[model samples]
Target: MSSVAKVVRSARGLLLRGSFKQAATQLRADISTGPQQQHGTFYEFRTYDIKPDHLSAFLKLTDDNIQLRTAHSELVGYWTVEHGGLNQVFHIWKYDSYAQRTAVRAALAKDHDWMSKYISKMMPMLNSQDSEVNYLVPWCKLGKPPKQGVYELVSFQMKPGGPAVWGPAFQAAINTHDSPGYAQLIGVFHSEFGDLNKVNVVWWYESPDKRAEMRHRAHGDARVVAAVRESVTYLVSQNNKLLIPTAFSPLN
Candidate 1:
C-alpha cells in the first residue's frame, strides 16, 4: 500500500477490517504503472503423461477446448512430446503474478460449462500430470518460433547456488549454438517457485535429421565444448523432451 493509502486506512478504521483492506488494495491498483508483469512474468509449465492410444484423442479434445483454457490466462506454447517421453503432452502458460494466477484459476473453477467441457473430459485421458512455475532468465528473453517447427525442451538441474554458479557458462553455450546455422533458440527459463535451481531451454528445429546434424556440428565446435565443459561442473542432471505442435496451438 502507498503512504496515502495507509493514512486513509488509519483514518477510516471505523469501517470493517475487510473494507479497509479492500480500500488499500484498490488504491495500490490505481496508482500502478501497469500489472506486476514488469517485475518478473511467471509461466506455468505442465506435462501430461498419457496412454499411448489416447494421444490423438486427447489432443483433439484439448484443441477443441483452447478457448476455455485461454479465457483464464495467456497460453505461451503447447506441444506433445515426440522423442523422449512417449505420449507426453507439454504446455506453458504465462501469468502476470501469483495473485493473478490464483484469481484466474478460481474464476475457471466457478465456470460450470468450462469444467464440464474441458476439465472433466481431459482428466480421464491423462495417466499423470506435472506442473512447474518458472521465470525467464535475466539475460534471456522469451521468443516465438513458427508453430510448425519441431521443438526440444531441455531441463537442467544446476548446483545449489542457483544461477550464480552456472549462468555464465550456460549463456556462453547458448551463444555458441545461436551461430550461422543451428537449431533456433526459442527461449530459456529457470525455476521461480518450485524445485529450485532448474533451468529449461527450448529450441526449434525444422526436422529431426536437421536437429541431429546440428547436434553433431555443435559437439565438434571448440567454443561449445569449452562452454559445456565449464557448465557441467555445476550441472547436476539434465533431461530433454522433443515436441511437435498440435493443431490449434497459438505458437503454431
Candidate 2:
C-alpha cells in the first residue's frame, strides 16, 4: 500500500468516533502535501489497435521488444482486451511524474537499439493508439499479487459529476468485495486527463476456477447486490478485460 492508502485507513478509523470532520480535514491536508499536491506518481494507459491479420505478429514484436521500454521505467501491467474493445492491446506504464515520462521517452528516442530494431518496424502494425494519464484514488493504490494468476480490469464510465456523484455508493460496493474475498483489488484509478469520467479497478484471481466460483457466490450476496444496484444509476457504461500477465509485467 502507498502512504496515501495508509493515511486514508487511519482517517477511516476516526470516522467511527464521531470525528468524521476531523478525518476529512486530515485527508484534505494529506492530499495537499508532497506528491499528492501534484498528483503523485502517474500512469500511462495506452491502447493499441492492431490490424486483424497482424495481431499475432504485433504481439510477438511487443513481447520481443518490450525490454527496450521497460529498461527505462516500469510496465505496471499489459493485456489484450477480451470482452470490450477487440484486437486491442492495453497496457499501463508508471512514472514518478510527467518529467520522468518525458526523460524516459527522450532516452528511448536516442537508443538506436529501440529505434532501428523495433519502433520503425512496429509502427506500421498498429492501426491506432489511444493514450490517457490517470492518478490512483486516495483510498486505492498499486498492488503486487502472485506472478501466476488470472487478472481482470473493470472500467466504469461514470456520469459527468465524477466521484462526488457516486463515491459513497461505490465505496459501499467495494466494501462488499472485501468481506467475501471475491478478488484481490490490484488498484483503482481515476482518469486525470483524456475522457475525464472514467475509473478503472483491476483485480486478480488465483485461477480461472477461483474467479468463476467467486462470481457465482457473489451473485447471491445481498450486500453486494444492494450496493451495486445503487451504483449503477451513476454509470454510463462499464467494461471488463480478463488479462494474462506478460512475462515482463511488474504487477504479475
Candidate 3:
C-alpha cells in the first residue's frame, strides 16, 4: 500500500476506537512527511456557453484575439466541449498569486483592443459563463502528454467539510491510477471558488477509444478497484467532459 493509504488506514482505525487525539496526531505526522501543497500558484478555470449559431465565429475570434488578453497572464489551455456539454468552451489561466490575478483582471479592463476587438464581440455570443479558482492538489502537478490529444475533465462533488474529510482517500485513488500509468494524469485541482469541496481531475488520452480501453484495464486491476471503492464513499456526485484542444492551446 502507498504511504497515503497506510496513513489513512491507520488513522481510520484510531477513529473507530474513539481515539480522536491519536488520529489527529497521526494525520499531522503524515502531512509533515508528505509533499507540500503548492499554495502560491492559482488557476482560473473559465467556461462559456456560446449560442449554437455563433460557436464557430466565437472560436475564430478567440483564436485571433486571445493574445491580447493572454498578454496579462498565462493561458494554460483552451478547449471546446466534445461530449459532456454542447456549445461550451473551457480555458484555464495561471497566475503566480491572487494579487497577480487581480492585476491581470485590472489590465484587461483597461486594454482597449481587448475590449473592442474581443469581449465586445464575444459577450453576445454567450448564453452563460462561469469561472472557478482552484489550487493543484498537493500530490499533483500540471503534466503534459506525449503529444496533442483529447483531454477529459472529471469533476467530483465531494461530500462537505473540505479536504480534511476526504483528501486521503481521494489522493490514494488518484495516485493509484497515476502511478500505474493507466492514463496520463494531467492535473488535479481543488476548487477555491464555486461549489465547495469540488475536485477536478484532468486526464489525457490518444483517443476516446483508447480512454475506454485503458479504463477497462484499470477497472480490472485490483488496486485501482479497491482505491476507487474506498474513495467513492466520500463522493456526492461526479460528472465529466471530453475536451478538444483549441489550435493555440499549450497542451496541444
Task: Residues 15-54, candidate 1: write the lDDT tens digits.
Answer: 4555766666665454332212246478899989998888
Ranked by TM-score, the better of candidates 2 and 3 is 3
Q: Roughly what TM-score does model 2 have, to 2 decimal places?
A: 0.80
The residue pairs found clashing in candidate 1 are: 147-252
> How many clashes show up in model 2?
0
Winner on lDDT (1 vs 3): 3
Q: How many Å off is the CA of 220 in candidate 1?
A: 1.5
Q: Model 3 — TM-score against the truth?
A: 0.86
Residue range 137-184, candidate 3, lDDT tens digits: 877779998997899999999987567667889988998888888889
Clashes of each: 1, 0, 0
The C-alpha lDDT values of all candidates are: 0.80, 0.82, 0.90
Q: Estimate each model's TM-score.
A: 0.82, 0.80, 0.86
Instruction: Tell me the spans in candidate 3 whose CA falls farther than 4 Å from its real position.
Output: 1-38
Best by lDDT: 3
User: What value of lDDT does candidate 1 attain over all alpha carbons?
Assistant: 0.80
- Best prediction by TM-score: 3
